[model samples]
Target chain A: MRATLMYGAGDVRVETVPDPVLRAPTDAIVRTMRACVCGSDLHPYRSMHPSATGRPVGHELVAVVEEVGPEVRTVRVGDLVVVPFAYADNTCAFCREGLQTSCPHGGFYGNHEVGGLQAELARIPFADGSLAVVPDVDPASASDALLHSLLALSDVYLTGYHAAHVGAVGPRTTVAVVGDGAVGLSAVLASRRMGAERIILMGRHTDRTDLGRRWGATDVVAERGGEGVERVLELTGGEGAHVVLEAVGHMPAYEQSFGIVRPGGVISRVGVPQYESAPVGFGSLFGKNARLAGGPAPVRAYQDGAIADVLAGAIDPGLVFDTVLSLDDAAEAYRLMDSRASLKVSLRP
Target chain B: MRATLMYGAGDVRVETVPDPVLRAPTDAIVRTMRACVCGSDLHPYRSMHPSATGRPVGHELVAVVEEVGPEVRTVRVGDLVVVPFAYADNTCAFCREGLQTSCPHGGFYGNHEVGGLQAELARIPFADGSLAVVPDVDPASASDALLHSLLALSDVYLTGYHAAHVGAVGPRTTVAVVGDGAVGLSAVLASRRMGAERIILMGRHTDRTDLGRRWGATDVVAERGGEGVERVLELTGGEGAHVVLEAVGHMPAYEQSFGIVRPGGVISRVGVPQYESAPVGFGSLFGKNARLAGGPAPVRAYQDGAIADVLAGAIDPGLVFDTVLSLDDAAEAYRLMDSRASLKVSLRP
Candidate 1:
């Protein structure tokens, strides 16, 4: 089986690996149909030190259940499935509360336990709780666009939805989406679905922000830092946005979020924050009585609805995938995403 | 007239000052009946540097309107009123949204424009938007208990309510209060009012924690640092509290909040955070998908309901004021609160 592996910064490769087997009664072996690059993966791509043994890499995947352990009841062989990045039993107290990411028995793929989900075949733990079987959608006959959208459900799209949902976006909300990455663009679409009437996309990339505008962003601020904050304030009648979706985890993006969030607004960070400490005192969130929310998207909780929306053609989040390549080209996918040459790249196995 | 002044850390005094005059159409001259020392005041009492010209101090006040400028419509001369600590023209967009503390034209009483309300007579700006007139109480004959509760409404009580409200305490909530100050205890009371099923008060002072327990803290953890976090986790079946009310502004209090919050929980800080930055990265809030909320209480927004509850005898937040002193003893009031000899001290002018 071919698997995506990373040896060091700016280094990713597709190499032959032993096939995964059912390890637990709750496990399933998934034959990858589609997998994609995530913005978070770039964090390691830019700074991870070189290693001799290498590390398992990709997480987003729309796969088919090739085999299942006896206890795996929700998904079975030959069924198309959208597997969330984080695996949870869906019965733990935390999972019941929709915080599956923090479930004690939950874990993410791309780690040694489950293996990188981008491989031809990968072990899935807690299969019954983690993956949603696509009803009536045949993997072999599904359109590439539908497959890409389902693959997005595995992470990015729902992550964007998580930002808007946690931020409490509503018809009265004026949303500001920081970072025009695939997640940010998806947030614009999400805020729109949640009924936000105004959305400002803060990004310097004209091409990417154009899509954000098309999706639902009424305004685009191409500035960064103080200037970007000023632009967003200008767009929202000098009061700033009611909800600021911070899709870029860098300090600058966070600074812009606190700067342009309304006095009682929420700043939701879906992008994995790059650094630890930041101002949360009178100089930032406290002064404004603002809220800071969002983290790893509880994708498993939203999977059922997202797949329905995708299948119903009510949403087209797959447009975020600007490029596609064979699984053997995972290296190129990583490179293209890192260099900003592609909004997002989905790989077919 | 005499006003309370802070010359520096550990140096507060009651000194003669010129009588206040109505400064604007929105201003009202208030004859201070009760003004209290707050935990936040202790922040500067411990750090403010000495100066020849001291800063005017106290903010919380229940007073009678001595005189009102032409445009002060909501309050009338000789009317008893509970003036919120931060004065605001409630008609503004921020005020209308119930975020009066962020109202652009609003300012606290101790600032240069208003003089200290812990004086014989103080000027209140935005009288119509900043004060809630007592429906039937006469300042000249009001009971000490009633006056004390109304004074609490100016800041501490509502500050506590703000923490619980922003934390979204509900019937199913398990709350952990991280400070035993007046505001933290107030938060316990507020959480109970909001229907929280479990309330854990974290503090070392038995007297203070006793008051917290009376105010609806179902459990008390006297341990500090890691042990406090451990005790709180134990109380909540190892998952931590659903809402951690941070009533102390120090980093340690903030640290305790993140430590004891359950995944998908909220950590609301009502204390004026003394420091600027803290970890919001993967190791803290982000990892648990926790939320960080709260700031200065928008007392003006919750005035009506809080006042009604106090008057209705449904809550006794006035118990926070364990000591009382004459206006001439402002210096002593500050000392008692600073040394923890008094949970809170109200001054009668």
Candidate 2:
């Protein structure tokens, strides 16, 4: 089975690997039908140290169940499914509270134990909780657009939805989405679905910002830092956004979140932060009486809703995939995404 | 008029100053009926630089309106009122959003222009919004107990209420308050009022935690640092509290907040942070999928509800005042609060 692997910065490759087999009664074997490179993948692509042995890559996938352990009751063979990046026992207290990412027994994909999602066949643990059936969709007959949208449900789309939902975006809110990546654009789509009347997309890329505008961004601010904050404030009538969806995790993006959030508003960051410490004193969130929310999104909790929205044709989340290739072109896919040549690259296994 | 002044660290004085006069259409002259030293006051007391001319020293007050400018429509002479520490127009967009502390025209007391609440007479800006009339309570004959509770409404009690409110404490929540100060005790009171069945008070001071127990603390964890975190986790059945009310603004307090918060929980800090930066990365809040909320409590927004609760005998927030003295003993009041000899000191001018 061919799978994606990374040996160092900017090094991505597809090589033959042994097929996965069910290791637990709650496990299932998934034959990947769709997979993609994520924005987070670029983080390692830019700085990971070189090594003789490569690490597995990719965590988003739409696949068909090929085999299942005896205890796996929710998903059976031949079913089309979406996999959350993290797998968890759905009945755990944390998972029951919709925080599957923190479930003690849960773990993310692309690890030595679970293997990567960008592969021909993969083993899934806690299959009942980790897999969501794609309602009314046939795996072999589904369009690439539908498959791509379902793949997004594994992480990106659900992450953006989590940011907007937790930030309390609504009809009364003016939303500011920071970043033009797939997740940021997804935030625009999610904010619109949450009924935010005013949506401001902040980014430097005209190409991505254009897509953001099409996805319900009432205004686009192609500025960074103070200027970006000013543009968002101006677009929101000088009051700033009631909800700020920060899809970029850099300190500047976090700082921009504070500067553009209205007093008593919320800033939700789905971006994996690059730094550990940031100002949270009187000069920022405290004085403004603002709230800080969002983290590793519990995508498993949002899978059903995202799938419903996607299948209903209410959103075109798949549009984020502007480039596609066979699994063998994994290196080119990484280069395209890392260099900003592609918003996201879908890989066919 | 007699006023309290601070010349430097640990230095306080009672001196005569000019009587307050109307400075704006929204201004009112408040004849001091009751005043108190606050936990925040200790900040300036500990770090202020020595100077020839001392700065005014108080903000909390329960007073009688001596005079009101033409535009002061909500308050008038002879009304007994509870004043929020900061004054705001209350008609601005921010104020309408219940964020009076962020109102552009709002300002805190103790500045040279407004004098201080610990004075014979003080000038209050935005009188209509700053003063909440103590419904049917008589200043001349009201019990000292009632006066103290109303004074708490100005800041401490309302601050705790704000923390509980923003953290979304409810019947389903297990609340942990991280401080034994007036505000933290007030949080125990507010959390109980919000219908939380189990309330944990974290502090080393037995006296204060005793008061907390009386106010509805079902459990008391006197441990600090990692031990405190472990105790709280034990109390919550190893899942941690659903809401952590952090009333101490130091880094350790903030760290404790994250340590004991359950996944998807909220940590609300009402303490004036002593530091500007803290961890919000994968190792802390982000990994836990928790939220960071709270800042300066918007007392103005909760002023009315607090007065109603206090007057209705639903709460006795004034018990935090265990010591009392005349304005001439302002210096002693500061010393007692500074040395922790007094839980809080009530001053009569």
Give lDDT tens digits, candidate 1, residues B192-264: 9999999999988999999888889899999999998888888888999989999999999999899999999
For every candidate, the chain B TM-score is 0.99, 0.98
Q: Taking the tens digit of each residue's C-alpha lDDT, what string does model 1 give over A47-104?
A: 9999887899888899998889999887879999998989999999889888899989
| After superposition, candidate 1 runs with Cα above 4 Å error | none
Q: Give all candidates' CA lDDT scores.
A: 0.91, 0.90
DockQ of each: 0.92, 0.86
Per-prediction TM-score, chain A only? 0.99, 0.98
Top of the candidates by DockQ: 1
Q: Predicted candidate 1: what Cα RMSD to the true structure?
A: 1.0
Residue A42, candidate 1: C-alpha displacement in angstroms: 0.7
- Interface CA root-mean-square deviation for model 2: 0.7
State the lDDT of candidate 2 residue by residue for A1-349, as single tens digits: 9999899998888999888888999999999898889999889999899978789988998999999999988787999999999889989988988989988999988878889888888899999999999866778899998999898898998899999989988898889999999999999999999999989898879899999999999888888999888888878778788899999888999999999998889999999999989888999889888889999888989888788888898888888999999988989999998889999999997
lDDT at position B126, candidate 1? 83
Interface RMSD of each: 0.6, 0.7
Off by over 4 Å in 2: none
